[model samples]
Structure formats: C-alpha cells, structure tokens
Target: MTVIIGHNPNFVPFNGRGTLRHNEPLSKHTSWRIGGPAEWFYEPTDLEDLAQLIPQIPDNMPMMWMGLGSNLLVRDGGVRGMVILTAGLLDDMIFLDEYTLRVEAGVSCAKVARFAVNAGLTGAEFLAGIPGTMGGALAMNAGAWGSETWAIVQGVETMNRQGQHQRRSVTDYEVRYRHVKGPDNEWFVAAVLKLLPSTIEEGQEKIKALLRQRGESQPMGLPSCGSVFRNPANDYAARLIEKAGWKGRGVGGAYVSEKHANFIINQKAATAADVEALIEQIILSVEQQSGVRLIPEVRIVGEYATTKPFMSETPSS
Candidate 1:
C-alpha cells in the first residue's frame, strides 16, 4: 500500500464549499479562540463534496479533521496542511429503528441529545451538556457524569484517506473508559447508536438538571475547553488543583477558573501559549505537592513557536 502523505493534486472548486488562503488563522476554528492558520482549510457542503476532494489532495500533505473544535487547541505556529471542517457537511441525524439512531459525525452533542429526547429515547441526556460535535466526542470518547459516548454506539461508518467508506461494529474497537481504539487512519463519518425507550418529558427534565449542574459548577460564561485534566485513579482532577491552592492563577489572559479547578479559562484576550503555560505550571505543582500526576483531556495540535512547547501539563482533552 502506498502512503497518502506526499503528493499534491490540484483541487477543483465546487459549489457550497469554501476554501481560504494559506496560513488562515486557526483561531476561527477552535473553542479556545486560539491558534495560527492551516496551510489550507476546506469546508465541504456534504459527504459527496468532501469525498471528491480527497483524491485530489496530495498523499503526504498533513490532513486534520475538524468539527466544532470544542475539544481542540491549535498552537501559535499553525498547522501544516489541509484542515477539513465538518460542521455543516455531516450533520444528519435519523432514526434507524425504534431503539437506534443514525447520527452523522458533525452533529453537535447538544443537538443529538435533544433529537434523542424528542424521539422518546433515554440514555443520551448526558450528551446535552457536552460542547463538542459527535465526531470530536467519538474521537475523545467524550463523557460526563456516569456516561460516555461510545457506550451506546452500536456501529460506526468511517472514511479512509482515499475516501473509501466502511461500516464497523462496536466489537471492532478495543473500548475502555473514555478511550476508543480501532483501525488506524479511519475516521468516523457516522454512528448507529442504540438507545433505550423513554418519555420526551423525562429526558428533557434530565437534560435540564444536568445543564444546571454544569452551569453551577463550571465557568459557564468563559471561553474554556471544558475539563483540562483527566481524573487520576479514583480522585477528581478538580479537587487536586483546588487543594494545591491554584485557583484563579493567571498567566496572560488565561486563568485557573475560580469556579472550576479543572477548567482553565480565557479570562481576557488570552493566547494559546498562556493557557499552555498555565497548564504546565499546574501539573508541576500538583505532581510535586501530591505525587499525583494529572492527565490532560484536551487535544493539543499544530506547532509551538518555542522549545518543548507542545506537551500539556497533563493528558489529551
């Protein structure tokens, strides 16, 4: 098999798709509102349009898939190649059966939660409060409270670098808590989620309560990437940070959220570097003080301008 990493094919323009200049600021794509630009950025109208452009793209060109960018952080140096925005192109959500739903990867988690509730489905209200698209959630095995995204996923439709698509079963993955692994280089296009039957009113009530809890516990109004670190062992990351007395710690525009210890917020006009530095400081302090190493839950991508600037204080978001 040939590697899809080296050739550059000319991209013919299509209707309902948009392309931008090289080095377009990545700040426009992330929830953190930070990042340099990608060498190329493309937003397709639909899956057909998306697939058409794939073969034209060079094999070695760095390709990054983007959804809502809620769980992502692109650095100041920007990305090297193509960044495909999936926000509008893959937003389909449909019923496959009485207890199963077909959801496109680009659909927002909140939208899916509402759709499930309106369709008399339960077990999906946990998605109501997540601030990312289904694809991002799937990539990160995004979870909250007691539920995770992949738990209800019965099957998934994925696309390869050559635009070849396939349907895979849940058993195909090595699933774990907040983690999912399958065939490499195959990204999710859609999912068939198995759900339980429930009343719309009941689901709505559950969503409301969850949202309320998030609002009270998190810095709901700030620009944050949600939880900064994964919980360690049986302990919560937030508690450790709070115990370290790092609350409200600020570096440039970023600050340790006074409201939630696990969240680092862009309090002012914070740069990506600001948040990055703060994350590191927190990790060093926590590890030195409590001997509990924290892991990040956020995805950090793109290049950093200075030495050793990429690794976060903890794990991937």
Candidate 2:
C-alpha cells in the first residue's frame, strides 16, 4: 500500500505521496554545486511506491529522470513538471549465482565495485571510482581503467515513464563509447551483470590502484563534474584542453582545473551560466587549436533562469 502526504505550497502535492519537495534546488543534487530549482522533486520510498506514484501524476505534465546527479548539469532555470529522484529508492543488490549479480538503479557505483570485490569478482574493479549510481552508469555506458559499464551486463530491466516494466537482453540496445541507445521513453531499473571469477585480494588491489591513479592525476575535493568533454577517437581530452592553454582559465566562478584540464571547477559561487560559458569556450578553443571537435560528455539539461517555456525535453538517460 502507498501512502500520500500533505501538499507542498510551491507545487503539486500528489495526494500526499512518499517524499515530495517543491521548488527544490537542484544544486543540492548535482556535483557542480550549481543549478536552479526543480518544480517538483519526489523521492519514492521504494520501487512499489514509485511505480504507484508515476501513474498518479497528471498525464500531460512533463517528467524527468535523474540518478545520483554525478554526470548532470541542470540549467539555472529550474526544470518544469516532475523530477524523479532515482538515487535513494530502488536499492537492491543480490548475487544470482557465482557469476551473475543483480543490482538496482539506486545503488552507487562505488558500492557495487566493493560488493563485487567482496564476492570475488575481478572485472568490476574498474567501476570503483565512478561516483554515479548504476542507473547513471547504464545511461552513459560509463567506463574507467579499461572496462565499460555494459561490457559485463548480461541483461537489464527497464521502466517506462508510465512506471511499466520490462526485461531485456543486452542485445536489445546499441552500445558504444559513452553512449547507449535503447528503447525510447524507458530508463534502467536494474541490471544483471556477468563477472569473472577472481580472488578478493586481486580485485581489491586493482580498485586501489585505479583510484590512486585518479587521485594523482585529477583534482578531488573540488566541485566539478568529473569530465566535461568526451575524448576524441585516439586522443585524450585533457591533453587537448591543456594544449589550448585553458588550464586555470575561467569565466565567472567556473575554472578549468590545472590539475586536469578535462575538469571544470566551481571555485566560488559558480552559476550555471558560468559553467555553460566555460564549456562553450573550451569547445571553441579546442576546435580552433586542434581540428577535432570535442563533444560534451556531461549531460546538460533544463533551461536558463529567465524564461519558463513549455516543457518538452526529456532527461538524458
């Protein structure tokens, strides 16, 4: 049974559902410490609660899907309609057998990596450093070290905007570097991954080594979305940005990290405009400096603060 709560003053109350907040500041959810508010942000208690809640919202209203907010950039203009917080709910992890593990969308990548290692799985060690949740990993085909998120997926379960569910095999989607194109209007709910048999000590050591490398080369403890741009084929993004002399440069409160040019830091009260401007500047600089046009890896969403246009854009997933 699902329980409804009281209504929020700024937005729809949905007959008092699980967790609802109106005009919720999205900066609190994202990594960059920037962004405007979401008109309605709801965190369901669990999968069943979420399933029930989705259909109850008016059909014409716009909807957005988000997880952990690690690889996302919300515009200074808050989002319209409903924004589903997919991080705290749907958390379930189970070992199906010696080789397969099923993980829910809300579980963090870090937690999955540790769980895999504890289960004596070797291949998942690369996921140890990805700060996003499994749902984000699945959406972006997130990778590190050498292995990508989909490389080990045996199957997946997805939920539509209507909260209907389906199970699909890996063959259902086209997977590429930093991209996963699958069924429209559906997002990952869970995945069953295939992993290699290995000793706990071996997997643990690999995780440590990979994390150590990231720490040495990248600026941790700073407010930044991990990587701003995708690396061109056979070329590193950091190398290109550094060559363009963008290191330590910025507009407003956003600056390119000297430690890693690929990262744009929110040093002091950075606005979404500042970050977006920096992104465009980097893109232009890199294109002029090198012939390769670098595409953004970070998912940019929502709109500017001034205009409230009718919502139509779907959240990247």
Candidate 3:
C-alpha cells in the first residue's frame, strides 16, 4: 500500500450508501467550531455501511473516527487521510431487555441519558452533562458526578479496519479513569448498558439537576472544549491552574476561561494554534508552581499550520 499525503487522485472510490466528500471542513462538525479540512471525509449511514466502506480504503491510508467532537483538537493544517464521522449517521438506540439498552456509537450521550430515563432507568443520569457520543464515552470511559460510562456497560461491539465485527465482554478490556484499552486496530460500534430500575420522575429530576449544575459551573454557550486538563490524583487541575494565576489569560483569541480555569474558550476567532499554545502555557505554569504536571484530557491531532504567525497579545481577564 502506498501512503499519500493530501488529495490523492489515485485513492480508491467509495461505493457505500453514505455521504462521502473530498476536503470536507471539520469546523462544522466539532463543538469548538475549529479545525481545517479533511482530505477524505465519510459519514456512514449505518453499521453495515461503515463495515462495507472500511475494507474499500487502502490499508496504508490514515483513518480517524470522530463523534460529536468534544474533547478534541484538530490542527489548522487539517487531517491528511480519511475521517469517518459517526455523529447523526450511525444513530440507533433500542432496549435489548427491560434492564438493558443497546446504543450505537453515534447516539449522543445526552440522548442516551434521556432515553434511559424515559425507560425508567436510573444509572445514566450523569451522561446528561457529557457533550460527545456513546462511542467517545465508551472509548475514554467518560465520567461525571462520580459515575463512569464503563460501570454500566455489559458488553460492546467493535469493528476493525477489515470490515469485521466482534462482540466483546466488558472483562475483555482494562478500564481506567478517562481511558480504556482493548483489542488493537478496532473501534467501538455499539454497547449494551445495564441499568437499575427507577421511576421516570426520579430519573428526570436527577438529569435536570446535573444539567443545572453543569450550566452554572461550566462556560455555557461558549466555543470551548469542556475540560482541557485531567484532574491529577488527589488534586484538581482547575485548582492548580487558578492557584497559579492563569484564569482569564489569553493567547491570540484563545483564553483561559474566567468561569472555569480548566476550560480554554475561543473568545473570538481563535485558531487551533492559539488553543495549543495556551494549553502548553498552562501545563508549564501549573507544573512549575505546584510541582505537578497536568495532563490534557482533550485529544489533539493533525499537523501545524505553516502559513500563519501566532499572535502575541494577551486579552484582558
């Protein structure tokens, strides 16, 4: 297989029943409203379509799987190969039984929470505050309010690059805080989650409360990734950043959110480079001041832009 950089005219044509486009802008898909273009972007209509399409691409071509695009940063230079967008394309949610729900990777986390509640289930209320999809939640073990995604997972369905599917038990993977490791070269396609019984009113009330708390604490209605840094063991990332006096600091259009120190807001027209620079600054400053290095919870990818110069001004707090 030959590796091609950008816009390969010799790439294999897709014959799936989904949308496929060349040089698709990623900014329209992400929560942060940032990113450049993808060399090849495909949105599969269903699991079958995705499986059929995977094997058509050359093995050497790069591939990236994305959900709602929270907790992600794509560089201005854009992605080089194929990007498979699952949000709104692979959506399928159904109850496997009275106590279990089968959710596809493209279903939003908030929708899953509401669906679980509508089914009189209790444990998924925490998912109401998550901004991404079920696939991302499962991949990162995304959690909030002390409840994690994997705790309720019974089993998962995965698809490899060869268009093959496998059903895997929860015990097949090693689950951790904001991390999960299972079979290599495979991505989650669906999951069966087990939940406890509860009244609809009770579950709705919990979800409402969680959303209210998130609205008040987070930078609501802003162009920003939810959280930039993971809380280190026995210490909060926000606390360290605030203590180190980084709150409301700005680099180009990206600024450390005044409301939440761990959040970097695109105040106005912030580029991906600005966000990355601010992230680096926070990491360096927090590590120097608190003697603890902060790890970014958000995933950063793609190549740096060679055309633009980084701005030097810092915005007002």
lDDT of 1 by residue, 1-317 (tens): 11121112233322224453344577987888888767667766667766666766788877899998888878787777778888766999889879999999999999999999999999889998899989888888899888999988889998888878789988889877667889987888898999999998999999999999988888886778889898988899999999998998889999898888999887788888888888888999999889998888888898876634322311212
Ranking of all candidate structures by their lDDT, best first: 3, 2, 1
TM-score of each model, paired residue for residue: 0.90, 0.93, 0.93
Q: Rate the local accuracy (lDDT) of all candidates.
A: 0.81, 0.86, 0.88
Question: In the order shown, what is each candidate's alpha-carbon RMSD?
Answer: 6.6, 4.1, 6.7
TM-score of 1: 0.90
User: What tens digits encode model 2's per-residue C-alpha lDDT throughout 180-289?
Assistant: 99999787889999999999999889999999999999999999989989989999999999999999999999999999999999998999999999999899989999
Task: lDDT for model 3, please.
Answer: 0.88
In terms of lDDT, the best-performing candidate is 3
